[model samples]
Target: MSRQKTESEVARTTGRLGPAERADNWRRLGSEEFDVVVIGGGVTGAGTALDAATRGLRVALVEARDLASGTSSRSSKLFHGGLRYLEQLEFSLVREALRERELMLTRLAPHLVKPVSFLYPLTHRFWERPYTAAGLFLYDTMGGARSVPGQKHLSRAGALRMVPALKRNALIGGIRYYDAQADDARHTMTVARTAARYGAVVMNSSQVTGFLREADRIAGVRVRDVETGEETEVRAQAVINATGVWTDELQRLSGGRGRFRVRASKGVHIVVPRDRIVAESGMILRTEKSVLFVIPWGNHWIVGTTDTDWNLDLAHPAATKADIDYILEHVNTVLATPLKHDDIEGVYAGLRPLLAGESEETSKLSREHAVARVAPGLVAIAGGKYTTYRVMAADAVDAISGDVAGRMAPSITDRVPLLGADGYHALVNQADQLAAEHGLHPYRIRHLLDRYGSEIHDVLALGDERPELLKPIPAAPNYLQAEVAYACSHEGALHLEDVLTRRTRISIEYAHRGIDCAEPVARLMAEVLGWDDARVAREIEVYTQRVDAERDSQLQPDDQAADAKRSAAPEAREKLTEPIS
Candidate 1:
């Protein structure tokens, strides 16, 4: 694990995450000693593993669920410089985030993160436009927002041309600004894959059950695979906890008081079809509580989100009736044609781990993250924006690198492009030719290239012998059958829910929340995962119940009621007997 990487070894760039890799990593975790063992598989954890591995340190990143299965996947999916933070006068945080944004946009992850425009609708005519413009000007200059175009001012007529769905009197004018957007789940998974390419043992569905200690000094972690129920002792010189909202829970297991407490705040979003609100670009509207966004998705417009205090299940933050109603009520005020319940396609909820501070409301809580050496050889980082994951990761590893022997290297992640980053633009240029070679349309080839980048060949290779995989999924045709197969074979998807929910996003992208495709997707996963008939049936049952629970939760009036309803669905993985160490 401590061997230095060589130039010819770049073929490892695929960063494949399948059952075979997981099994090999599990065996390695039991036998080899690591320089750092990172908990949680969110973006921060994945970034930390990359930071450690790139520094020539042996590292392993473990997660209880799929990569980005938590808050990382359910973000507003923007790499903006925190336009709202500017209002709070948090110049430094915004500046740091913008720097990371430019890094992802220009160098690190161009394939996943792309430029997106948002129109800030004006209500107060002269005052609003100037105020917003000044704020945007500062945003542009603060962190080198040069990757995308600067802000553009528009009159009412021009604004209507931009978004025809707006009520005639909704806004007097508007200002358009640029920011980057990404499929958060895909981006996080790529980061993990990149870390693996650099020789980090990255595996999902591996839960850390307890901390390992040697005479009161942190030694390593006791991990259990959620899929196989196999426990292993993974020794490390240092351990990093990047569990986000679950920070407090892990800290308690360490039997220590944390440097700061984390508070959970629930944010909910609803997805509707693209035609629901006719718009050339996304829209941003002001609300008394928080800002509302109508972001443009591929074939849909994502409208959301409501921010409120949450004291329920962190894993499954349920979106109640009131939450969806609040969003519709606010967005309805300006819409020429108000969206109805039937127009809704999907709903999702994620909990933000805000650093608990002196704030009366969760919305006003601090988002700036804090890291601490909770104990000897143990480090924990909690609370930060999604766009600044790299910075958060650098700081986490910086705290523990002193414990590793020899001269520790500085962070080189700024120059480290993700797995699909190399040759992405060139492949995009040859999309038509690639389509011809693959017997598909140019648009489909372009889509695959954007998602898989240079690794598009690996995905396409899955269907070389089995051509039917190149066809679309019967239930959710937007995604090809090969995608479902690749989810298990290359993306570490262990269950049917993981395939529909995180890996491919058939859950939120479709109207049925992927229920119709549950059986078919499960069957495909079974082929790769070696699931029996009973296991396949259970996977489908768990997924169906999960979908039903979410719908039931959305109908509830409050958090407590919604949580109780949502928790009714059983976990996809059944509890196994004591793990064979």
Candidate 2:
């Protein structure tokens, strides 16, 4: 169920980031002088743009690729306080993350973020329950967890009742606690859209080539349109480098040694069907290295995450055979029926930009974020968990006080809800009515509400001229044709890869990894993007090759071989160049 907003509320905040919007923003990027110019289009960069825009600062955000194309898109999709961090005695970090979790669940993104329960199995009978209970107590009470339910203890029989797929000898007891989850890519894109709604000029496929230096201080940046190979200059009082794994690389481009170096830690996750694991609630298992999670997706189970050091291509982090085997081997220990390679529907790898530490092990690295003014007018933010991105954005903006003129207003993003957040509850209650009006099922309407919230009206309005757009996609029936069109018209999705992979999860959620629906989706996009027959064929070819490369990479034995296989595919943004360190 979802709620509806008034027409004025929708019109006021639901500004489209369509093709025209990008063209207008590109003109402003070259002509307008801004107080802040943000590099990167991940969660942090988008959040910084929002934070600055809400403060009445003239802001522009430029991304090398589509929004959430990096680590932001390929995460575990949880807005959780790292439960394992509590064991590290990092109470402040856990509490801060929990607070942010609560904010997103209640006031911030109620439509996107939802409460999810996780059961922790107790192996050693006597001490394990109480020991885990104490940590969970701090988790619930330390942060204001008013909306979510508290912890509950269950016996072996109770545990088996909740999760029938778990092995009988796996645990003596279980403890259940609450956390939150969302579509990370969608949430990040919404934040960027919200920033645009607040008057920030946000454009994707626009890369920052180099820093514009005036004497010793940084003035702005040299921008390049990755699509057209044309260049322009953006003048600003302050520039924020929020490129996650690429932080050190971007800092070097500014001709300054960074105060801290960001090391890339690779994490891999595999997606399997829901029927493979018969669990009522998600599970948290203790591994030798770190904790493993079995998260619940719509009709699938997302299990994984192997943490290891990565030193290869930052753009395409490959998941090798060893990585997939590691996850399956660990998870199979407790499952009644073990999962195999044949059961895997999808596999993805992402790099975390951890601040380099003395510890050689990537798992031992800190999740705490740091902000440093690397130069007179340049600030770089790196490290940090996904849950604390708002706090990080605030700190990054605060560090630029010396660069910007006048006493800049403080960040008000804490109070500012993302574009689709407001009036979402009312829209949930009106889902049936919306479904009736839009000529779709109530379940489909509910799906749209979760993704677009009050902006569902804007998405549905596109189908008025073309009634066929309201139907479900041929191969990817989970999504509608309207969504494919909306990705180009409203969301800043330029390439077919952007639409299939980021804008929608067809790439990972389906068995064919979007190959089955490539041609259809490309043709749908062509209607909005003005692509001819040759262009449509080219888009499908590129996307198919990328998918084939990923599949081949996953079969490799190690990172080196996997990287070679994955990197063989051509980039969707052909004109974009990687910044040399």
Return the clash pairs for model 2, or none. Answer: 1-428, 2-427, 2-428, 2-429, 3-426, 3-427, 3-428, 4-426, 4-427
Give the per-residue lDDT digits (tens) of candidate 1, residues 172-269.
Answer: 99999888899899999989989998888888878888889988778999998878788899999999999998898888887778898888899999
Candidate 2: residue 275 Cα off by (Å): 0.8
Tell me the tens digit of each residue's lDDT in model 2 across 1-581.
87896332332256567777777788889999999999999999999999998898989999998899999999999999887898889889998998899899989899999988888989997888889899888878887355888899999999999999999999898998889999999999999999888888888999888999899999999999998888999999999999999998899899999999999999999999999999999999999999899999999989979999999999999999999999999999999999999999999999999999747888888899999998999999989988999999999999998999999899888899887889999999999998999889999999999999888888899899898999989889999999999999889889999988889999999989999999999999998888999989999999999999999999999999999999999988888897821
Top candidate by TM-score:
2
> How accurate locally, in lDDT, is each candidate?
0.88, 0.90
Kindly report which residue stretches of model 1 are placed more than 4 angstroms away from their true locations once superposed: 1-13, 576-581
Which candidate number maximizes lDDT? 2
